[model samples]
Target chain A: MPTLEDDDLVFRFPQNCGRSTFRIAFQRTLRIPDSDREYPLPPGLGTFPLRHAEDFPALPDRMAARGGVVMPMWQAEALWINCSHAGRDDLPVAVKIAAGKINAVTGEAWRPGLHRDPQDYVVAPDQPWLDGFASAPGQIRQFVAMPLGDGYTAEEQITGQAEWGGLQISVTPMKRAAWDRLRKAWWPGLGERVAYLHDNFDRMSMGLGAGGLMRQRIEEDPHDLADWDQRATERVFVSLVHAAQWSALTGQQPPTAPPSAQAYAKAGLPWFQHYGCDRPALPGASPLRDLFSVAELHKAQTGQVLPGSQDIAAELPVRPFGTRPREVRSPGGW
Target chain B: MQRSAAPSFGTHVRALREARAVEDSRFSLRQVAARCGVTPAYLSRLERDESPPPGAEVLVKLAHELQEDPDVMLAMGGKISDDLRAAILARPRLFADLIRALRDTPEHAVLRILREVRDGDW
Candidate 1:
């Protein structure tokens, strides 16, 4: 079950699975200009406040039954998923993240079980954060929020339907035996004491639509597929409620509006460039390749224009942040 | 999950170092050890808990280099800095009582007390 810990959703595994936990947070960030020019990664503003759907009145029964959480987003705000492990040496958990039932990596429809040929899910602790849909190699169209039923979401663009309008995440952890064997082989020097350290949706609100392209590579899984415990998967639905509806349903104020990409650039805040593992990157998904950006969709739907549609030319310095690549220590000698 | 016991001083130092290193490559083991005037081999042993935690000078240097509060680094090393030790020794009973009274309180409450002490009218 996933518990809200310090604003991050902490999914704890069963005792049989060594009780390792995965933490994920929905971070609010700048909505890059939806233009042909790919932009640098934006800075994280803060986490979007989340609430259990059951705590409020007038929630859809489907959401409650699926064990869903709710968070408010403005019509055009953007978000990114932040993934981490509770402790340093815990086993990596495979996470399948789909926005509105469309796989963010492969752009396939939501389905049970992990996929290896295309590698649909991300491995936590290895791939720390997912900013947006994998559009191409080392490039992702940023996730920008748009109201459902208007035909801007990846779900609507790909599926030709919008039945599910929220994010779905299911996690599968490594089997305990595999972890023990790997630990014994991988870290022979470290003593035993070190080992201990390890929806719904409703749609009524918004779903993720691809925005501008950013430089990000969704890494291919390094561990063998056999290591994952396929049977012990836990899934949750995240419903994105619009600010007004959220206030009406929960009777609380929604978060302030996010700053525009242009404004943020003008303010001289450092954009981020995450230096991740050197693993091979997955080829981008085809279904999501040609989806219209929010700006493009808005321009096509309504004759009126949105400001800052053209890519910002400002030279926003990119701040490099990443794990220093260490020597790859393999569990030698099978 | 509850931890079996509090982490050792070496474990805490390694965790802090690694956390910083993960955020920025400038804090890599060799880089931090070099910046803090220590050998990487010795630092690695200290991090892996094979060696005892270092004294206040190294801890203070590491705290400064890692952008952590010096007091926190000293406490994590299971040592009170000389100045703090002198202050405690000057009023041992009162300080002990104050520490005991505040130990069980939440961090926010302690922070509130700190703010009051800083902004209070003497």
Candidate 2:
């Protein structure tokens, strides 16, 4: 049970074949008031977790005493953008949701008469893991996998991302030692067949191995793409960006003035509470600090905490997934 | 089965049901469903095109309650008679005529033509 906690965030990696867990006790969500729309944190509070289910109770918690290690978090469907035009740390942040980059707020289509591209973004093929999850050959899941407000692949993929001055954030796998610990803990039995068993889309996602061979036999069953949220996508895929190529994915030009700093802040942009954690080496501050914040939170209503507390956090570290994400650069530049 | 897009086989189910109810004020959703031995909710879903039509027996029962042809109801519910479909598929010329009739003629007329073809002199 390697663990780390700060305020309301907690990360737990269990023994037995299971992946590390990254969860938040309290989630910060953005709502445009009366509208039903919600955005994933950029940095959303929790990128969908890559989960595995094994009988950890049967195994010993040997790793519990390994002392917490420093590991990086892998937020699902998120990407990074390094733009000099962004507001200062204290700069105002605002949000403008749109089909492409046009003012979806004002109903002015990005191209006036031109048909808006779907989700206003495209995906790249460089990251092979997405093959299983892409809605089409080289496309990505729209509302389900896309961040609260960014686009994907080809130069056109990120057309509107420049508005927020943040391109889609892509993360590599954890370091070999760190990933090995999770991999072995998660899928100990399968060898190369592990890819088929990897976790994705939180625990909601179904895996081939999860259903065994019978599922694969009927894997081609017709699915209603409209019901995407009902389905689970792959997790290992790493989306890449080729500025020139990325723009090619879209028809409209990336918006000129990204959301004013004020709009970005008002959009309720999420601040990662556990970006860089204090030493996981220590028992972490306080005796029950880990569960203290949870205890203090009002049950609110029965339904919020029912079906078990959604506030439980996964114990994973913030580390480099692959070498590329560490250095932000254009596609081949890395 | 692949979910249909628009105006699938079940497209006309609701309209046909509404027409039946109008013709016979006694024709009610609950009453028709009872004759078919199904819950009104299930029958409502079937009529609204929200559900696939049931087996042949249920289709026949519901058609009888509405005083409509079973084969026509089956087609409106996106269900095709397997024997009839297979027979049409086995012949190129006959299959072409069936396709033309289905596209150009009304369901009642098409069903009549198909039956006459199946039962009449070659």
Taking chain B only, the TM-score of every model is 0.80, 0.57
In model 2, state the lDDT of residue B55. Answer: 84
- Report lDDT (Cα) of residue A282, candidate 2: 14
Which predicted model would earn the best DockQ? 1
B1-122, model 2: which lDDT tens digit per residue?
35455565454656656766775655688877777799989977876668876887787776666655567767766576666678777896977875775774653454343211011000
**Candidate 1 per-residue lDDT over residues A72-166, each given as its tens digit:** 88887888898866534567789999998999999998888998878999998788888899989889998888887777888888876656677
Report fnat for all candidates as fractions from 0 to 1.
Answer: 0.00, 0.00
TM-score of each: 0.72, 0.20
- Candidate 1 docking quality: incorrect, acceptable, medium or high: incorrect
Off by over 4 Å in 1: A14-19, A188-203, A324-334, B1-122
When only chain A is evaluated, what TM-score does every model earn?
0.89, 0.17
The true-versus-predicted C-alpha distance at residue A89 of model 1, in Å, is 2.0
Residue B35 lDDT, candidate 1, scale 0-100? 88
**Collision pairs in model 1:** A199-A237
